[model samples]
Target: MQALGFEVLWKGKNFARLMGGLWVALRISLIAVGISLVAGVLMGALMTRKNPVVKALTRLYLETVRIMPQMVLLFLAFFGTTRWFGWNLSGETASVIVFALWGTAEMGDLVRGALESIPRHQYESAAALGLDGKQSFLYVILPQTLRRLLPQVINLVTRMIKTTSLVLMIGVVEMLKVAQQIIEANRMKVPNAAFGVYLTVLVLYFLACWPVSLLAKALEKRWS
Candidate 1:
């Protein structure tokens, strides 16, 4: 085990540190995901409207998120914003902000797509049933929209989980960063620790994400 570098994980509190780091990453992503879902639903509903101002603003936001790298966004939020706005944001806070921005954009588009995918006949049918616009949306449209939206949303959860690794770049001591710390500490003693450490991180991430992925798949299958 020492030769293979697995024993290094047993030395002191290294394994516990890794678990703590994983929680940090999850906490950031889950918080951002929660914020995105609420805001994105509102943005998406607005996107379906014919308001020119809303269109322009939503397009700008969506496009900016699409064009910018997540890393650049992280740096902009963590480093640039503190200087520009004089707001002292912690790394975890900055990470949550950046990921929330990114998630909101992506989720907005997904919501818009889900909303638009509903057939015109469905609306007409709801009207034919003497349903008012609000009633129709609540009883008919919302149920269908949620069905289509949920699988994609679950998929987004997994994406966010994996992407949380990028938070390390902004000095958030997430799982990857903790792995690096462990490896760096034991470098002289375990030359091959990097591989084992990274492999463990990879496995942990896969374990974290795989169940979410499976849920998304099951949802798509059940709803398809």
Candidate 2:
């Protein structure tokens, strides 16, 4: 076995460049998650409405996102439609846009589930306490929705972090891309370096994602 080189990962200008790419990925994920949360909440609220048109539209949106692979969505956003619109969008922008759109659909569904899980009597009780629909939701329903929503949202964030790896395929030089570069560079000297590099990348991903998973578990335990 090759000596495990902790120092290799930490030393020099290359490490800084690798981390810079990671920051780009993190930034994209953060913006995507934020946009998705707002879009999801609004969509979830609309889903709760009694309007058939709204329900049908929301269902169609959710189903479309569900049926499509994320890579396909990325391709469609980045490559398929830009020429038709005469709009110039970069790889990172396209990635964020696709992830936000995808995440909104997912988060909206998650929010709907959490909101619906609340006992109907909670709304009734809020109404009985002289709270109007808006007030009731703002003060009562929203709080409970948040309680349930937090764990799921945390889980989604971790998923988002992992999913960002896919963006490398479209030429975004994130962590995976950096690892691929390293593997290629080392492959001549160390024939099995690709395996080692990939193993390291896997561990890095686990390091990044595990805390979010743990946080979700803790929140679930605390709230449930």
Candidate 3:
């Protein structure tokens, strides 16, 4: 019991507090995902354009996001923006902004991939059905694009949820931050609190992510 360390959860409101912390992480990720989905779709549509200027700009944004470590982006959003722009961004807000940026880039790439995966014949078929350009896209292209993107989007959301753990470093009071607090508070009373608490944390994360993971896999299998 001491070695596994879960007993700490039996005390006070520790477990409840951990659940609240998890909600915080989920809230941030959900909000970020919402923004990313809308913006990413636009960015992805733009990416399919033939203009070199737009392509270059999108490519630059994608490469910049890929090249920069997310930790650095978090630090910049939380600290650097406050210093340079005098914006009093809270840790949670900064976490959301950073994550939204990351998710946007990721979702954009996925959308682009999904859009590109459509065969040229689909468009011609839509036209043969007497569908105009907008109707053709709305009825044919959009459905197919969404079908391809669905599984990947589920996977992306799971990644975003897990990545929310990093927000704790910026003092976002998330599950990991709560776990640390619980361990530190019980250091003397529960010598193995760290191990048990962290183990529990792992389980909580897996529980939260598992359903979505299963859905993504099922989608990939059924849709593939």
Q: Give per-residue CA lDDT, model 3, range 1-224, as digits (tens).
A: 76767899989999999999999998999899999998988888888889999999998998888689889999999999989999989999998998898889888999899989999999999899899988987889977897889878988888899999999888899999999999999988888899888888898889888988788778778777
Cα distance off (Å), candidate 3, residue 8 = 1.1
Candidate 3: regions farther than 4 A off: 217-224
Give model 1's clash tally: 0
Clashing pairs in 1: none
Give the lDDT of residue 114 in candidate 1: 90
- For each candidate, C-alpha RMSD in Å? 1.6, 2.2, 1.8
Where does candidate 2 stray beyond 4 Å? 1-12, 217-224
How much is the lDDT of residue 155 in candidate 1? 80
**Per-prediction TM-score:** 0.93, 0.90, 0.92
What lDDT score goes with residue 42 in model 2?
86
Best by TM-score: 1
How well does model 2 score by local distance difference test?
0.82
RMSD of 1: 1.6
Question: Which 10 successive residues of model 1 have the least lDDT summed?
Answer: 1-10
Error of 1 at 45 (Å): 1.1
Task: Please write out the lDDT profile of model 2 over residues 85-198, one tens digit for every residue.
Answer: 866788899999989988999899988888899999999999999999999988899889988788778888888988998898778899888877766666565656666666
